[model samples]
Target: MECPNDHILLSSGLKGEEKSYIFRPRFNYSKCTKCSLCRDNCTENAIVMFKEGYPFLMPTLCSGCKTCQLACPSKAIEEDRKEIGLTYVTPVNNNLTLVTGVLKEGEERSYPLVLNTKRRADIMDFDLEIYDTSAGTGNHVAAALEDSEFALVVTEPTPLGIHDMKMIMHLLEKLNIKGYVILNRADLVNDEHIIPDYEIIGSIPLSDDIVQSYVRGKPVVDAFPESDASVELRRIMERVSELLW
Candidate 1:
């Protein structure tokens, strides 16, 4: 996996800091001897020599390890920093906090941002931390869920959803992380669907109130306490509490 580096800075925002950084190679042509040492030593093959006898970097392929800089015999390579993402800590309420990682637009790499976000959250004082990972089985997702005591594998009743859910479950098994399934939008399918070798903790039917809560930028439990989704979610939480505690 390609990774650069990270640094946390105190932002003007409330109760937290922002971290965003990536290192790239900058060539000092005046000092370059065109020996191709930097290109030769690059493990990622990010450097290429022009017909004019100079090296250029493909930023996307570079791992930003500074290997080229260190290997340059003529001291031509220099360090360049770019902000790739932002990590934010927001006060959700008196008892809750939210830490989010956002990658810059057009940035392809997300593993470093995920790592920095997790590091930021790990430093805060808390009794429990609920990590909400993006929908995928990529390395970024693995990094986010690594070291978690257990995971709630949320999935829908659609065919694509079930297929992807199984892939995620396989990943969790390989990571030695225990997992339980939560069937979301369970009313969409009438057939009896069951996940083998994993317990189903809850079944939540699709509800309009849940959609409204999403539109209003609030949690369903807070926005619609009496809604069916909210009730089912509370039961799921109780089950998880019993399993963990």
Candidate 2:
């Protein structure tokens, strides 16, 4: 994630002190050589020397200034720019469009891709724009769901799924965005306490037809409208349609 490393300078009154803060760089240990050059050059004394002679950063004390990067002989210090994701826009129908983003294998950052994909959707002329954000409450998901009127968080009934569902719910509250839950694989468990506080838009039971529709390159609602999961999906759509209209 490329954070804007700008320092906020504030006036200090006590003893002519200046208050400033900035986001420091996180070093890539794989690329860094144990030369200790970066540690020696850091004016803030943020970098400490390891027993192996390699330098590690103390993020709190480090300023956003690139003095260490400029002074390093090996050029090991580099800006964090993980451009390993792509935004995809596909027209599902005249009324429905799908804008998706996928991070490349081994890449962890997801916000940029989400932001880019949302920008693509914003450009299109449509009455109701829907955004399906990636899981988690990280800044990436926040970037995707910013300014959204409503959000639907889908989760399974497993332990991990329930844990993550609570996490996203808290995040929705923090962002002041109203959210509803959709419990997938509902037949697998009977744990309603996982999301006791939030409203459940719909619960979709496990069904083979739902999987088959995906394999057939068709939406489950379009292919098997009578299925249990498909019916729940329609109910969700109807609720959303009512809210929008």
Which candidate number has the best lDDT?
Answer: 1
What's model 2's overall lDDT? 0.68
**Per-model TM values vs. the true structure:** 0.86, 0.63
Q: After superposition, how far is residue 45 of candidate 2 from its true place, in Å?
A: 13
Best candidate, TM-score? 1
Across 9-90, the per-residue lDDT of candidate 2 in tens digits comes to: 1111112121112335556667787778778888889889968766777764664567778777777777643344555555
Worst 10 residues of 1 by lDDT: 3-12
Per-candidate Cα lDDT values, in order, are 0.81, 0.68
Per-residue lDDT for 30 in model 1? 96
User: Tens digit of lDDT per residue, candidate 1, span 123-225?
Assistant: 9967788888877898888998899999999988788778888999999998999889999998976656544556889999999998887676567887899
Report backbone clashes per prediction: 0, 1
Q: After superposition, how far is residue 217 of candidate 2 from its true place, in Å?
A: 2.4
Worst 10 residues of 2 by lDDT: 4-13
